[model samples]
Target: MECGIFHTPYMRPGRTDKETFEYSMMLAKAADSFGYRDFMVGEHGMQAWENIPNPELLIVAAAQVTERMRFAPMAHIVPLHNPSSLAVQVGYTSQLLQDRYFLGVGAGSWENEAVLRGQPGDLSEAHPRLLEGLEVMDKVWRRQPFTHEGQFYKAAWLEAGIEAGSVDHHDAFDLKDGEEYHALADHSPYGGADGLEIAITGLSAGSPSHVLAGQRGWTPVSFYGGSTLLRSQWDVYSAAVEARGDVPDGSRFKVARDVFVAKTDEEAKEQAKNGALGHAWSKYLMPVYKKYRILQGFIDDADVKVDINDVDLDYLADHVWLCGSPETVMAKIERTFEQTGFRYGQIAVNTHDALDDPAPWVESLRLFATEVVANIEVAGSKSPVHEFA
Candidate 1:
């Protein structure tokens, strides 16, 4: 299995923007040094506890300090911005990073986030807009003139332009506000720019959004789930892919986990209880989820039902978190994959404030790379997998 780091950049108390940003970048840089596959950052505007408004900027900054590791914004909220503008920015970003980045798009998730971003739609309304917005972006990235008129968004295609040095051509495209184009003419030798890998984040088990991912042959990233929940998501994605006559490959899937590691299981659990990881969920996340009425998933799992009021660090450490020594955590990960049959998917570990101490956190990442990942064996596919075969 390929391993990667997924940073949410949850701003915690006692840390300034500059400190948090610098520390987060340090994690990304460390991931690169440790030879992780990819580094993904998240975005959450107006949520002071999770301050990154544009993850792309973080990716750009991380790119300068690291080499070889692919960088991505875990998602760009689709409904809050013009799709055409998003297309241009992402396309340019891909080019700037030498096609070493992927785009993760999602409908606005939280109602509060939507309100904060000036998009006050509910989740139901955001879904259709996410679909339409992606359609618009896809059309624009084809490097050809096209027009789109959908329920949520409209785009008029602009023809490709002449070389930057050429004075013969006038820019004919009327771009969306803050959008610009940079591409050779359609007939130029370099006309076919590098295509981007687009992945969609499936936040809930069996989300209908997975169907879009399947139809488009994009990667399905399961956000924060154990084996059972992630398996349900894969089932949904696989069925949708099969419906379109495509093979379902587990290697293309991604699973996100919240992890913290130390020299031993006891030490790890203790640190998790006392560290920034503990502070974030207890103080900021739980309260917001409770206030917003979105704690059902975290509170009620398939095998357990715990009252939100009674949930604590001990409960979380046992149920949701992967906190232990390298060997201990590796065993848990092995069990998760064994249960879910996630053979070759990217096992993405969510970044925690556990790294704020620097020594233990860095050691954990290094140990994960050296001791855990080195010993894990992936079940490789011998042939193109068909439905249920």
Candidate 2:
């Protein structure tokens, strides 16, 4: 399986934006040097914990510092911006990165983000808006002059300057007799003949995003969801693809997980529970998860009897996180593959802030990259693990 890093950069308070960005760059460089295939960064507007409103900027910067690692916005929240503007930006970034860029789009999931944008904070319209936005972007990328009059957004580029001949006026600056005017330049993504790859992420069971991924032949990303949700996502994705007379390729599916590796199972567990991962979950993510009522899904999936309130770091370490020695983490990955019956092509390690001292955090990444990844197999074939000199 291909391994990568998914960075939300759940940075705690008190750090400058520049500091946060540099930290992300550090992770990107590390992942790239470690032979990761891709690096995904999240976009959030309102939340301080998950900062980095425009992940495209980060990806652009990351592309300069790292070679061979592809980059994408874990997702750009579609409902939060004008689709036309976003389309141009995405196109420009894709052109800049060439083959190293893909697009990840999402309907806004956080209610506060909606409220911050002066909306009702209801996500009922988010999905529809997302679809409309994507349609607008698709039209833009096709290099066609078209008009869209959708319920959420209206866009038109039906007139081209080239279609109208230049006026015979001497006032025109530096105009030659034979000088020809041109239409708007093409702003399509740069991914050779197949076009740019679009990835959509799903966190809940029976997520429509996965179905949409299948229908559009975009990459399907399962983000930090448990076994049940993973299976459900694959089921819906595969069903949609088959219904459309297309085969579902597991190689396009990406599964993001909170992972950490140490010298031993006990050492990894202690670090994960007491270190940055534990603090981030307790202080930031758990509250959001509780607010969204997402814990019940995990509870039901695990068949646990603990109260949602009581679900602490210990619970997460035991049930959710792949924290252990290389051997133990490999076993967990193998189990997940067997349980879901889907040999997902990519394993995106959900990254967290390393906080003050970066030794343990960096060590975890090194071990995961060098050791755990080397011994893992996907679909009965050993991975081409990189050998560090």
Candidate 3:
């Protein structure tokens, strides 16, 4: 039962971008002092509404302030960029962090990003393109010169410059010019063998492709819904890995979600209920739900009556949020653990995250770590609870 913080900064219209950036880092540093396992950040670029455009830069700054906290860009928009170059950037960053960095890649969204790049829909469906991207990217990181001539891009470059004077140009390859494949592998900003960890997400439900991910032994992640969903995903993926008779690096399976905590149950509820901005946020999100799937209630048949277009403030306050006083939060936290055995938490201590100010949210997380998490961990409780996982 390890705990950690996770966030997407919930780019509200009123919050200043700089304030958002500072507040995010501040929370990261705070999470470190509290002995959190990790501080993960999400990335969104070229979107005016989503502030934290580049998570890697933020992680670099966060790394300077916190000593104990492990940090990673929760996910990087990989589909839009040059895959090989992105891999190199990851490699270089890993080197800078002394091999502390991990890479989470996903196909790009954001219509503006695609339009700016003159693309259509999303690059996620182009599975072969994405696969080729990872192949070339990993080869570059390992500094292994391999020729690729499948679909997307082709290259024959080695880590060593020109394979010791055997080739002189980019197109020059041993297969063609009677020289082994070669290229320059330098310690660039985010490239080369400082132990780069690559995790590809969205493996699809129960698909055999998931077994391939298990083969590489990289972490897999998914969003949407609550804790049970994450645990089940990890279990299925882990089981598949085990079925292959390969002992996975057990730590690779992770579950993440937005969380906020407070000192007392009363304060926690007050902070969350009073911070009704979640209603406003929900208004903007209803269509995405309609397009995909609706949110079902979690635990104990908590019925919430709210219109899709007009999410009830009270309904969201009670149903969607995982905020409460230490005792209450502990109960919910314990329920989550007993139900799914999820070991990580992405605590959202920022005020805007709960439609409140920063102070209350931060206080909540500190109290949770001190009281609730402490009790459960110490008691070694094994109370069973119902869960979707």
Candidate 3, residue 89: how far the Cα is off, in Å: 1.0
Question: What TM-score would candidate 2 get against the native?
Answer: 0.91
Candidate 3 regions off by >4 Å? Answer: 14-17, 109-112, 122-126, 158-185, 188-194, 200-213, 224-228, 247-252, 276-280, 283-291, 297-311, 337-356, 376-389
Worst 10 residues of 1 by lDDT: 380-389
Descending-TM-score candidate ranking: 2, 1, 3
Ranking by lDDT: 2, 1, 3
**If both were scored by TM-score, which would come out higher, candidate 1 or candidate 3?**
1
For each candidate, the alpha-carbon lDDT, in order, equals 0.72, 0.81, 0.56
| Cα displacement (Å) at residue 288, model 1 | 5.8
On a 0 to 1 TM-score scale, where does candidate 1 land against the true structure?
Answer: 0.83
Q: Using Cα atoms with residue i matched to residue i, what is each candidate's TM-score against the true structure?
A: 0.83, 0.91, 0.76
Q: Could you tell which candidate, 1 or 2, scores higher by TM-score?
A: 2
**Residue-by-residue lDDT tens digits, candidate 1, 1-389:** 56777787666755677787788789888877776777877777766666787787888888999877888887888887788888777777776786568888888677787776566546566887888888787777775778787887878765654434455565444556655556443321112333567788876667776777888888777765555667778888889999999888887877677678788889988887787678788877667556644455545442567887887888777666777888888887777777777665676777767545777777777766656665676655221112111
Give the per-residue lDDT of model 3 (tens digit) for 1-389: 34555555565666677777787778887666666655667767664445676777888888888776666666676556677777767766666675446667665445666666566655544455566777777666665557777666766664354444454554533456755444445654343443466655442334333444676666665543444454556566677778878764433444444345566556656566565335434544445434433344242224545545554544544565566666766666555555556543333232245434667666666665565555554232221111101
